[model samples]
Target: MLKDDQFWISDDKAKLDMSVIKGYLARSYWAGQRLEEIIERSVQNSLCYGIYRAEGQVGFARVVTDDATIYYLCDVFIDEEFRGMGLGKKLVQYITQSERFRNIPGMLGTRDAHELYEQFEFRRDGDILMRRRPDHMRS
Candidate 1:
């Protein structure tokens, strides 16, 4: 858990405002076309963090980890209305500093926000990130 005057972040998935998460990701380049069931299933399976203000959830991040070795960070976002207030930095800082993940190697894919992630020591590995989508995902 992390908190300040106006925002708080937690690892409790039950506390997540799924509507807020779904709404944001529904329009995101990476997840915009994802189905609600897929979103819910992903959140259920991953270690999730939700950032909130007085009103409601405003940011989110999820990590897929084995509790040792590797950690894949994904779905990171701070609401457009909530950006520029350092909340994104705070969210990443909290995750990177967490004892559970600090020593583990991490990976992520982003077409933007490289600078934001670089601040936390995340760098591009030589190999490109790739995926093999399921048959249902074939165009």
Candidate 2:
């Protein structure tokens, strides 16, 4: 867990609010078409992080790892109402610098937020990132 002023981030899955997560993902272009069941299952299988203010859950990010070599960071977001407050940066920094992931290579995909991840050493490598939209997300 990490704290920044009035906001805090936790990896305890028990603290995540499904409604809040679902609400955001349902509108996310990368996950908009994903089913609720799939979301739940994904959360269960990965290392989940939730950002919160006293009001409630406000941000989220998840990493899929083998507990050995590499990791894939995805589904990262800071609530629309809290976008400029730096919660997203704090969340990414905490996770990336953690003892387990600090020196390990990882990858993340973003169509436009490349600048944010670049600060943490995630560079743009076309070969490292690829895409195949789900059937429903394709036109």
TM-score of each: 0.89, 0.89
What shift in Å separates residue 84 of candidate 2 from its native position after superposition?
Answer: 0.8
Candidate 1 lDDT over 6-122, as tens digits, reads 899999988899999999999899999999999999999999999998898999999998977678889999999989999999998898868777777777888877778777777
lDDT per model, in order? Answer: 0.84, 0.85
In model 2, residue pairs whose N, Cα or C atoms come closer than 3 Å (at least 3 residues apart or on different chains), thus clashing, are none
lDDT of 2 by residue, 1-139 (tens): 8886799999999999999999899999899999999999999999999999889999999999885567889999988989998888999888887887876677888887877887777778783462222222233
Worst 10 residues of 2 by lDDT: 130-139
